[model samples]
Target chain A: MSTPRTALVRLVAGREISVKLRDKGFLASTAVFIAIIVLAVVVPVMLEGDTPEYTVAATGHAGAVAEVAVELGGAEVPGLPAADITVIGLEDPTAGAGGDPVDEAFLRGADAVLSSDPDGTVVITAQENVPGDLEELIAAASSAVTAQDVAVEAGLSADQLAALTSPPQPRIDLLDPKPSLPVPPELVIVIFGFLFYFTVLTFGASIAQSVVEEKTSRVVEILVAAVPVRWLLAGKVLGNAAMALGQVVLIVGAGLVGAQAIGEGDIVAQVLGVSGWFLAFFVLGFLMLACLWAVAGSLASRIEELQSTTLYMQLAVMTPFFSAILIRDEGPARVALSYFPLTAPLMMPARVATGDAAAWEPWVAMVIVSATAVLLIGVGARLYSGSVLNTSTRTRLGGAWAAGGRA
Target chain B: MTDATLAVQGLTHDFGQRRALDDVSFEVRPGRLTGFVGANGAGKTTTMRAIVGVLRPDAGTVTFGGASMTLEVRRRIGYMPEERGLYPKMKVAEQLVYLARVLGVTKDDAQARAASLLEGLDLAERRDDLLHTLSLGNQQRVQVAAALIHEPDLLILDEPFSGLDPIAMDAMAERLRDRAAAGVPVLFSSHQLDLVERLCDDLVVIHHGRVVAAGDARALREQRAGRRYRVDVGGTDAWMPALAGMTVVGSGPEGTLVDLDESADPQALLAAAQAAGPVEHFARTVPSLAELFAEVVR
Candidate 1:
């Protein structure tokens, strides 16, 4: 016979794989979900409008550089006086002589850098503390600078320069149609969306399934005979978490590998730090939902009642998704959801991915989520041990709590 | 060496306000097969779980090897729960070896032991089949083998005969008897009273989480023998002869039953019955375990 530790691992892993693979509905759901996310990413960016443009400003030969600025910014080259945008041109009056209030004002106010040069040099700079849209702004400014150089080299006449100055509006059609969210970090949205949805669906069912299976099969009697309720819970939590961790690695690694394989370089790193935080959320999320799942399983006398009993667990999972979706664009709610433990795994990662998360937010959110996870695991173990053997009618959440005090 | 492989005292477990097992006590000695007999929900499983240290009793202690059950004690105990659990996807051989490993056996030894067990149970051919693919009886054999692969010193099997056919039951009984003979303490609960009677030396009967009766099976059976008696007659007759303190349990045409008074002399009771008719047959019998169970449970 195998060693107990190996036996436990094999039993757990074997059981998990069987249950996971046997349910075609689950596999199908996961497949369809992955397809939806892939399409969701692929469809929007391909058919959507101009990859949202951002304006840039250049100084030194101000007017001479405006053309390059617009080309570089990947937006319309503002004619003479730009509308909805003010591209100030400065000569530094005293070239490198310390304080020029006009240059300083425009430098402090600019939103992003486009390009830089000296004499006829184009110095594209942003005054804003952070780039509003760095990728778009940088792309536009580079294109603008390239167009200016072409015109200057060609020795184009004033009218010719003006005509050429309009810097080709990029006839701007991307034919290959790769989704705009092209990086692995960009897939974070899809990763979190898929994992958050599927993890809850998959792992939540594992809990309920194990509970109901044990009850229906009458295995709970034997199990409770040998180990503390806590050990079972711990073993299960570890087992299912391992499963989730595997999925997390698969999805993340697959996305990273897929992105790199397709020439989408180094996107995983963008989301690596955030993914670590995502795991913290997953642990917390699992803890909260595992409690509900176990409670649901205990109340269910048979497998048929398992689905019905898991309704509360379903609702719990949906709360975070609904919160994430509805107040997603709102910063405070996103921040709140990020730290709310149950919602953090789903919401905080999205906020971090979208660049909406503040510096201390993820850390604070992690602390709160971790504390909540540890707490729920303890409470879940207690409730599971208490009510697992009570094959009576459905146990209310209160009953599990009451069970706690009984022991 | 410990005389009793396991000893449980004042074990109690409660779920909410209701107690599932209350102050139950029992002892299982090496070289003995102890039967835990009870109807469904009679706290036999609860008591066993408490003894195994799986379900912590509210007030009690279960000692193995003369000390409280610890991880070490658990490793040495073979437990077959009523609820048969095997990883459905795992091959039977793989499953057994894994269990052996969990009990601290080396992989090679565990594998060899598992093979022998499978061969013994006549499941060597199906060793590679996933547990779910096996018939229920075969799966049950696998469960048994899994429990015994490590050759534990203390074996606790809860309702081991729940689903086995008669032949399988006999095989299981033989296995248990063999193990007990080898100085392993075997404690098992079963609704099959006849099997328990045939296989067990001692019996612990539980009712509603309490030990109702616990002692040598023969002694317990003898306790209720006041209702047993034999009558003698020369020929078969329709009428049953009545005697003092005796009611007719069964009567042939030739004779009547005279229940013996516990305080009365058996020789006098037999003489009284013989005075009414020519003596032919004389037999005093205690109820079978089944009858005993019915009486106790009722």
Candidate 2:
């Protein structure tokens, strides 16, 4: 009558997956993450890369000033093509075609109009505000023209006037410089480490909460009677791990695809290369902690009690996560930490990012964590098996382990 | 019958230093509803847990169909713990089907069984509702239905009727009876002796982790009766209390009931009742199951 243990495990795991898939919170959070990834990738491309161009409508004297302005402005604007200046001629008042031509130029999309009044005062007009660069250019041109004429009248040569007009600006420096932002490699490592830390805690605590829920509801008793205790543990751990891992993959996949689509292929290659290493570490690390989370759940009989029982596991996951983030330099300490199984998931990815990890370092670290995680699975299953059944009393891990020894 | 009898023999368990069960033994025979009675903490739950393999007995053999319990046999046992355990968020019908599926029932069979049990228990309307949304009495009915969903060969229910309303109790009792009639060995523990007395074909009384009394229901009553007699006199005359080695146990419109010591004969007590006044009626009265439980427990 009984089903195989693997089938029961599969059934339980499937139920867990289906339950989370049906959860509104899970779906909503997943959606939010994808949205963030899309926005992060797409927003920047839409905002940059525009070059300003100026079109001016000018009569006789102002036409000369507009040409000079273009020359000065073209040299000043960095990282953009020189702003092009188009000058359209209009009839002078002497021709008796007065304000109409100015109005005509305005209809033709001229950026600004320049002219000289009968009294010889300069006039510059824009229907809207002119661009800052354009305005600065025109003002500089007006002053330069007046200065050059005055210098010639006063018998100074063009070279001398040009030298005098261009002032020598002193260079400024900071006494204390802040360090540069993280390089792409380190940044990716930090991001990957952060995701690993965040998801492990989130999914781990969720697994713990669910376990306590089953214990409190006594649904676990029914489960225990029908299936082996370890199978339930294995199912729950694998189920929630799947949720966490899949979410991580979904979020990263979304971000990476968005990045690749928008011509951020450099980023795509940077992240994609080390992704396998981080994922391998992530699976091993997540697998190790997920078992303990089940233990945390079994140790506490009530939901409220879960907070205290789960704290140790929180510390266990958090310590290495914080260490990986804080220890950025390439050194013996970092290298040793990367090799340590508990710290490896967080540290090795960072080392990989910094190019400090050798090609085989991650492989060795993975082997160590894989061996440890597999070993801990047995221990966690024992603790969970011992504690989950004594539902009436809030079973302690030690008590359960002792009882597990006897049973 | 031999193939279907769930025989639990010499079931002994110790919790730390405390002996929870000591040489407990009983049978849930085929085609009978066996009522298991005990006081609180009297090892009914422990014995049930042992039978279903939830708790390992320190010493004992639990065999079904004359073979030691295997995974196959254990799956055939439908056990409900003293505490009600079902997913509060899960739908009623879905939960039942899931339990049956875990026991290796096909999806079609599980679905059909779930629907049928729900209809029979008057919970068809609430089948899709979350378990917590139902009233507690209705939830108890669902718990009983869960045990029956797997079409189990043996049903062991602990405190299955404790929280049931009268109507819900009757519906569940009917289900258990139906299962028994279908040749399943149904063993349920309860504090409600009257209900047990009315429904049970056989009884097992455990006190202090020991089987104090167990037998065919009517046969137990017969064996424990015949020591007391009821006599009705023409007038309100109390004569039994004055007689030697006789005690007046109760007085009613019909008679004065007297308990006779070995020296005081039941016939002699009847004669004394006639001498006091013209005797109207005289007969021996058997105790109800409630009285039997109380006497056996004492």
Candidate 3:
């Protein structure tokens, strides 16, 4: 058996959820947001056009050069296409040549033409811009072949010659070990930060708007008489919070699925790794702002008056969002923001994404934000209960506080 | 069914420097329809609000059934504010059920009650429609239903009949009587003195945040009526003005309206009128509620 207050709160929350779910504006905006996330994920995969096939028409020694180029260019670059090059033999260096080397290469059914002069000058021609990796490969192959010829002429033994002519690769040793999880893309981290900011701000405004509507319409009079004021406030916050959380889950889930489908599994792992922290921070941060929004809403008797009354609260939610954007790279600023209750929701998740904050920082920020949220609820509930039924011109915060104390 | 008496004692409230309710006191007895009547801005709404715990009185107590009005007590009280309001976007039936459930009724019971109330209010067809879509009179009926959905122990309605048509008013009056018959104390405020007088078993007239007069409706009328009389003589009475301690207030073909001093005898006046001519009719005239209200507030 639930207490009357608890039961009433649940009823209120249920009503809010049902009403919002039926609201076409809310549904449409959520659909639009989901569409954007899906498009963001799917568009890049669609634009990564089919793999190109490269044919190099080579004559004499240059044919050997083309094979070496293909071998070196096939090595993987993290986010670019795989190299696929085929070589074709030319019996005479100038047999199929014309004044325009590019035209001659195209007539020979090749992407590029490669030839070596007897004096050791190598010429490469292409009809259009060559891919950066393909150019690098051709340069490296020509240098390697020249070095091998010199090594053989210097009278080195077969083993020594092989060692001298082969490419020299530098070995790397990190002083600190790399993190087990790959860093999330900076764009992805920024997206999460904005998502937190937009959801909290929009939902917080909605809570205030609803409060003012109830007050202006005078439905709150009946509501307050039927139940405790705190219960109504609790119900509203919980209801809107549930809706906001659902939206966040949908967006985050869609992003993960899209990333995985596009073969960006590394991003998926990184997002999942910080998702717990993001959710915790989002919940606490939204609660903290939502309480104040309830207070601001109770102060205004009409929806038209809401903007003037809730200006300070709006600024409070926006300040941290803009701060995160402006001072994103400043370690000290991010550290301070991650621990500050107001900014922590926006900054902490970003720091986690960038790997700038240590493991313990998020926990500390969580504790601080949660504590602040509890305190805000206490004060916010008092203000709400006190001023909710007073349908005067407008309720002053100071007066409401005094009345709340007595209440 | 428990009969509860709602007592508001010395309730005082202030809005900033101005007094909204000043030492107002009244009682809504069990199984009685108590009409709270007052002029506009006379603090009737404020007193009602204080009784239901919507506004905390600065210095007073509102007790229901001999205990202070707590959340538990308020749960059993149905209140409608002077400014009628409901969630415009919500369906009528859904809104009623929500209000009922919040007051501790079971979900199924709440739904049933909402349906019954809407049916009784002749809003069965509009139950599924959003509240704002109804005409103002019909919406007012829905507001009344919302108040009665939980079948509260005490019903406090402020200006419940303000926007209602004659038929709707009668329906609301009938509902109030039914609630009172079921042992629920109903306190409602209205500026319409005629309807209040016709519907109320008890009358509490408030003025300037104070209870000016309160008692049984007939008793209040009789009390305000005082020693006034109307005597119909068979012919034009020439000697009526000569009576001591008595003044003719008005005279017409039917009768002469007379105002007598408190010590004057009504029997003596009737005999004198007969002696002058055949007394066709004689009776004490009771003051109407509007007249009583004007006299008291004045």
Candidate 4:
């Protein structure tokens, strides 16, 4: 009898594995999405070029400064020529003096505007203000010219005034490891953070969908009749866990192979090794979530209710992504999420990548998560067995369990 | 007597304030096909689900072979649920073997059984096809094959004929008969009264979640031996109330079908009806199962 049961469980697992592999659209699309993430990181790093160009818009003296900067190696904002700057030298049309400020007119026709007043002041008026980066450049140039005028009033030689206006070679370090700029560790953390959240969400959603389909189709009914609800649910969680692990292995392993082929160092291999831990938490994490999803599926009478029930589960998966945006990888906010079972599946991976999580903490956290998963499966199985077949308007937990008690 | 393969004793299940099954009791013996007949929401599926441990009843118990339907007992009972469900992404043969293997059949045995059942059901040609790729009727056949693949000692089917064409229905009926002849107890519910009459050895009729009538099929007919007369005449309805100990069951353009009490003579009923109006046809006969169902439920 035990031998048969063991074979039955294995059979279920094999069926699950075979079915997922045969689902060509899902497997292919999922591979495509993960590949896009890898490309998003690798393409930017692999490009052998200067940093991205920043577009600047201006006119008159500001335009001259921009042109000089362009000659000094800055790229111009494409499509708009210096016609607006040439027109700005015209008199304002609204003024009785016939100063037709074509720059302002051009700015009006344009999505934005730039203009200068007669009192040596520049006033920008447009449907929308320019971005602050361009505005900051204009402000810096204006201050430099004002300082040069002050130097001329001091009766210094023109060369001396030019000395005062000497270009501020600030010797800024582009590689300054500032608190604001992202570090390599931070990038690694961000990558794993996204992977953790999305993998749990995608795979967990699949588990929920599978459960609902089984219930809706009445397959669970026959299955429950044949085995204890525990074995049935356990076999499903274990089976799907194996399949999800297979997909993760395929994707992450392929990434490692690609990285090695390109001599890109072992950073990807390290990430893949870290993913083993992520996958560990993910299995326990998925088991916990899959139970809740199955419970939700059992509670609902129609397939339409699936999305609403899963909305909370999705939020649980997304909490790590949300917290990462607000705090440092090791910050208390994120650390707390790492310890939380619902959020740990995503959070711990982020911590591991950033070196915020200790070697033992993640394993301990995994233990907690696995234990909780077992507990939830028990609760979920009972609720599912009690109410899955009951199509009444109400199958409250109280009533669902007591239904079979009297008999 | 042969073992009572499945038994329900005073089973009562409630949903909130309403009762889904009330004091329902019946026995299905080996080698007999028990036809469970009921209208919509009449608890046929509920009872079947309860027996299989899919739904727990609020009161009473269901026993298979005089033993309570534990997990082991359930493994030995074949069940075809009312709501059809197959993994749409799974291949036909793969799903069949999966279900069979889950019932504790060895992997090799399950595969062999699945192959034979697919061939028997004329589904061997499409064994490798995905379930969603099949036509609706063919999918229904696979569902039946899944139920029968393990070949348990007892079978419970709910609305098995709902989606089948006439040919499939006959095949299903033949399968049930064969299973019964092999000494496996089979109980099924259907709305096809004629099929039930022809296939069932005993019948159980439930109305509003209560058993209103039950017995051997032919014996039930014998028990309702009160004479029924069809008299083709004018003013049959008007003449009905005048007859002593007689009731109007139904009437049509052909004639009025009246049931006479056991003490009332069929000859007297026809004589009185003819005296009152010009009679075109007169006959005394037994009521069809359809009519008996309507009469009992009403």
| Residue pairs in clash, model 2 | none
What tens digits encode model 2's per-residue C-alpha lDDT throughout A75-103?
Answer: 75442235667777765546745557777
Clash statistics: count for each candidate: 29, 0, 0, 6
lDDT of 4 by residue, B1-298 (tens): 2475788888898966989999999988799999999899998988998888887777989988788887777888889988887788788998898888788777799899999999999999999999999998999899889889888889999888888899999998899899999998899999999989888999999998899998788888767756777788875544454577888888888787888886878888778877888888888766678988898889
Considering only chain B, what TM-score does candidate 3 achieve? 0.94
Each model's TM-score? 0.69, 0.85, 0.89, 0.70
- Recovered native contacts, candidate 3: 0.77
Off by over 4 Å in 2: A52-183, B233-251, B258-281
lDDT of 1 by residue, B1-298 (tens): 6465688889888867888988888889889999999878888877877777656678988887787777667767888876676666667898787667656677899999999999999998999888889999999998899779888888999888889999999899999999999999899999888888888899998888888888889999889665566575675564365555556666666466666565656676667656766677777777788878778877
Lowest lDDT 10-residue stretch of candidate 1 chain A: A77-86
Give the per-residue lDDT digits (tens) of candidate 4, residues A1-407. 34366566666667666766767866886689668756754665577323324344456655554444333333333422212121123234666345445454544343334445776676655445664444554555565666766787778888887667664456767774433322265665666566556666766766666667776677877887787665656666677777776766666666666665555655665666567777777677777877666666666665777677677778876776777645673677778878887777767776776666788889878877888888888777777666666543435667655542432
For candidate 3, the per-residue lDDT at B164 reads 87
How many pairs of residues collide in model 2?
Answer: 0
Better of 2 and 4 by lDDT: 2
Residue A229 local lDDT, model 2: 83
In candidate 3, what are the lDDT values of residues B70-145, reduced to their tens digit?
Answer: 7878888888988887998889999998888888889899999998888888899999999999999999998998
